[model samples]
Target: MSGNDIDVYLEPLVDELKQLWDGVETYDANKGTTFKMRAALIWTISDFPRLKNLSGWNTYSGLACPTSKRRCIGEDADQDDSYWKKRSVFFELPYWKDHMLRHNLDVMHIEQNICDNVVFTILNDSVKSKDNLKASKDLQSMGIRPELWPDEGGKYPSAIFTMSNPQKNVFLKTLQNVVFPDGYSSNITRCVDIRKRKLYGLKSHDCHILMEQLLPILVKNALPSPVSTVIANLSSFFRELCGKAVNPMQLGGLSNHVMQILSRVNDQPVDVTNNIGKTMFPEIGKASRAVSHFGLTLMERDQAHRHVLVNCEAVVPFIDTFRTETKRKLWHQTRSPSKIDRVVHAEFSRWFKRKVPMDSTLHSKEMKLLACGPMQARCFRAYNINGYKFRTITKEDGLKTQNSGVYVSSNTSYASMRDNRVAVGSVPYYGNIVDIIELNYSCHFTVVLFKCIWVDTTTSRGIKQYHLDLTSVNFTRPTHTGDREEDEPYILASKAHLVYYVRGEVDQEWSVAVHVKPRDLYDMGGENEKVEAAAFSPQPGLNMSAAGDISDLQLTREDDIEDPIEDVSDNIDDVA
Candidate 1:
């Protein structure tokens, strides 16, 4: 037949075969069908030798050719059957490259299908080999069969066998050189080989076992470094198949797991400053900051300790003297600054007296005079007692007193007792009364006095007195005139006093006054109230009196005689 005639006749047949091949459904039972069909398609293209030489035609032929009738129809037609065979006769023999290329393509298709099925079985947990076999039977029942073989007869054409041999060699070589040479271990290499064998109809359970082992390796290897390095290397080696049909969801989950592992290993605070220029992923920065803060707080909590000490010196004095009843009363009462100030001053004064020294050079002459008992007494009478009495007299009485031998006026009576019984007409009985003068100074020195008073009233008649003596005290260190000078003047002064009649009041009323050096008498009402309260309700072991009262009374004639009658009347009236 003419080449054109043959082509014309074969064209419709080829078209029908192509349609059939395209329509042929894949079968699970017939594992080799797809590979066989692809092989037959390559054979059909080879039948048209002239077309095969065209540029880009080989690819087209493989894609478009019939899946059957690629060789001669007659069983015995060999040397003279076609021009292609004639050329093969002229050339030494048919080369394997052309045949192997098509065979490898077929083998590749089968291998891919096998891998897809295996992955499906692992991931889905529903599909199984038994299901695959059933599916393959269903396809066969529908008149669909593998296209490479013309019929179910045992013999395959010589050209087709030649094609398959080269195909096997090319496939195995490609696997060894391109896929396996990347240093995967022997076990993995054997696993992949089995997968290829399965594609060629060598069914074995080893492929499933290998796949099972491969899954953990993939998961382990794809994790973040450095622990996952081993697994990652293995996973990367399988990248060829992994790239083709990986489950994106599973991959994403794996990536997240890897990220979690990395986050734990590198538990440093994320540098938020680094994100200042990045506006696209604001959420990432925020999340990182939160994680960093959490880590920081956790670390701090993991490594913490504490120590405490309280100065109990001030409290030590009150420890034995404090009373539960007094504490309860004080707790119920609102706090007063006067009380607090007194306690604080007392504490500081005690500390200063015990720990600090005084300098005498800073004292004025007047202060020195006040420090001496006689001088202080003399000054006190001249300025306070005499002056107070003198001011109380009216102008008429004052003139009279200037002439009278005795200042018998009601207001001047108290003064007459202290000053020698001065007859106004005669020389002053106490002698020339030095000019009464008052001097004021800072906290250089002070004298506190106490006196008893008695009242003969029907409701009350008793003597009450309290004495608190404080001498010149310094709060800070004495200053020296020169750093090297051993004999530096004292920066403070000392004071003293006699209590003969420092305080006096008639009746049940008595009050003490604190006279600070250089002549000032501060009423003890405010200054001593806190001390009086504490002394009255002293704490446990320190309470001096069991009566619990700060003010006590005792009847005594000395108290009555010392109290001024008019003053006593006034005090009684005030107390009432």
Candidate 2:
């Protein structure tokens, strides 16, 4: 497919589609393709059919058979029809025998539908006259006049398209005045920055931002009490679920909104978002109905949860291979375009997961490792108790997390320990070198799942380290012993989310010394301190089995001879 919306290939899958549509018993002669049935795990996207059909440009629903008596969506509608197309390729799917929901509503699709309709209904003439009037009156209250807005040609383009030059100028000024949380600056969101681009082609994520941020600001105190409350309340749910942490609260809120949406269905166990939205605003309801038409409601579509989720593990390589072969550069036009091609996919678990096979000897796995780009010096200082080594991370989305070195949080005390945060260069904190495992999930910056080990100071031995792994995101550490001031080190252990080596090694059989024991001079009663084993250094013969792990710190002579400018490795194996 090209930008011109043409199927550039001379030979199409026309013959194969014909057999699938007809459901003819194939004696292997009719079907030319090697695989009679290739699986399609996810089937919903714009212009795409869950059954055998195309998506986007050049969509083909074999021989449209929508008689006046029956509307067969399989061959007619992109959405719901009066009748299900039994002749659809749904029966042709070989994997359907394994129990799978062949078609379903994508969350992205529903949310995008809600967003697009919400904007269009209020700003365009598509909605019922009453709803439009209410929306217009609300806008007028905010000093906005409907007459000043540009007249769109029926199709509700981006709301920006409705604005006159002066109106757009005002809108731009208001948008520029708004601010967002975190250190993020809204300066880049200015009209000047986007002058080269047309707002009409705004993607779903952009609409989401508009719904969450700018929409609320624009509609504040403008609409009728009911309209304002409903819109705001509804938007809150959408806002929370946007490309971020899906906490219990967010899930609950979504369920609650879904229930309210269900109320419009009147106790029937069918999706009625369209019913409710349309009743509220006919256009909004239509938009939602269109989405629901994608399949049966989210609930009814997959009753037994019968579906195969082809995760990033499978999808990423396929996508990467496509880009590599086609020599196509990745999407960089928008902030984070989540369209079919633009979205980045990565697994929560790494290739070298403790549970999963870590054997990177496989060519594909080796390529992923090689694609891990540059290594941090901290990796050279990498220590492994038995086979469990430190994690190596590269970028956060497309941006490099570490400019000079690994991502060390400057928001020290009150920092998020999970997302690229560690008290690097701080003493007693890995003694300036904590072991890390490179998290596998990084294609998109949805979540960073990696592990790091920090020396737990709770025990004087310092060997009792906190095991910060994937599971410990919200687990807050107990208040530090003497942390008083806000800026002081009130290290939340939950924030510490670090992990200690609990598995993969026998403590008695393999007790390797990593760093020197931090002994208190007062506890020793002024005894002269002996400095024999330096950090990452292995002792040759003497193994202090009687003492704890750190007490047996020893350096090999060769390692001892060289200045410890570089991180020493493997030499520590001579612990005894």
Candidate 3:
């Protein structure tokens, strides 16, 4: 097909393939066949550039309908609605069928060969130039000596040395026996080299062997097993290898051997509840040569003690007295209170005094009292008794009264009353008190208490809001100086009201006036104004009052005998 003809066919195919890919689970096993079909489609579209267009015979036009079996299709007919529709339908059927077949094939191929392919790829990459260089450098840093020989180009050899504190001769003997068993021979160099390259060919296995050999040594020191049992186990293991020369071959074989011994040791009946009594190792026939040196020193001390005689006749009483005094001193020290105990007690006393004061006057009253103080004004909203909506205020509506009744107490007298109550909307009343005192100045601050009560008038069943107590209410005062204070000194031009409603039933509410104490008003500005006026004013003269009264009399007479006032008079001059 010509390039344009091919392009027309492939563009739709590409778009359909992309849509199919998005609609289906792309990674599903069944979708593998679709990928193969997609690949085939791509290959076919790529070959579009190779097809030649025949001009005179109209091969392209013939090829447009493939029934003609021509090499190229005409672009004009390919763009035709009916022709393209037929072409699309023809292509879609095979595309879907091939996609399904190839997807299944891909699933099987992935299942059978993907894991091996991943493994080969990893291994191949690991052996690449950079990786090899890194491996060589790591081996060199680990002190692996390089060996060059005529037969072998080069190889790195491993080094082995005694890990623990070793006696030179004993270590030398052990090394010699390990490498040159049955006397020296031609293979001595190779054997020595192999021994030196302790962690060469079987590096992973060599590490495991070393770990196993060190297990018994670590267990002897670290096991929570009884001391006697641990000692006995070590003794038994050493006894088993007493006569046999220790060598690398034997060392490598120790992991299985020691494990076998440990398994048998564990199998021997043990009392789970009384493990301390259980003997880990039975008595061995021979002793370990390494332990014999220490054992001899202990034996010599015992023998020397057996020869010594006790001479406690004269000094016995003095020694006894000294021991008694020392015991008494220790006992007294243990019984005495520590410095930390005293410090804790002092801190507790201070904290108790600060948090719970000794002066009862500083304490708050049992019942919280909400009040309208000097600088505090009350704003209230009223609700209809039967309806959910708040009562609307009108110009003709008369003032209403709501009383909270009397609260009688022995320590304090508290009651609430309200008058001239206007019906405001359910929204929060936004108004400010003129002055508020800082917390430091106020002896006791007033809190605006709110309680929500749900009353069902029909059934006369009311539910007080849950945990709706005065203590839980969070009250915050203004932080800045510019804004007016909510609690301040002010004359109540009208009665103050306690505005509240049922929880979530703000639409139904009422207000009652509660008189507040003078102390509750936080009037910081009132105190400030008095201080500023005192500082700026002139000092008063006591004698000046009499003179001021005489002046006042003269002015009164001038006002009483009013005549036609002159343009400029002596009385006016005197007033000025």
Model 3: per-residue lDDT, tens digit, 1-576?
A: 343354455567667666654554345476454332232332221111122211112223323323222223233444434323223221343354343221112222222232222212222222321224444456556443233111133343221211222222332233234432353322222222222322112232222222223223333332334432433453445444443565666643454344334433322211111112222112212211111111112322221111110011112222333334344545646433232222222232223223323332222221111011112222223221111112212211574532221111111110101112222233122112321111110223321111121111111122122222211111122111111211111211111232322223342332221222323345468544655343332433212233344544544453646557577778788999
TM-score of each: 0.13, 0.27, 0.11
lDDT of 2 by residue, 286-307 (tens): 0101111112223211210111
Candidate 1 TM-score, true structure as reference: 0.13
Clash counts for the predictions, in order: 15, 23, 13
lDDT of each: 0.28, 0.34, 0.27
- The TM-score of predicted model 2 comes to 0.27
- In model 2, how large is the Cα lDDT of residue 285? 7
Over 4 Å off in model 3, which ranges? Answer: 1-202, 214-576
Which candidate number maximizes TM-score? 2
For candidate 2, the lDDT comes to 0.34
Of 1 and 3, the candidate ranking higher by lDDT: 1
Ranking by lDDT: 2, 1, 3
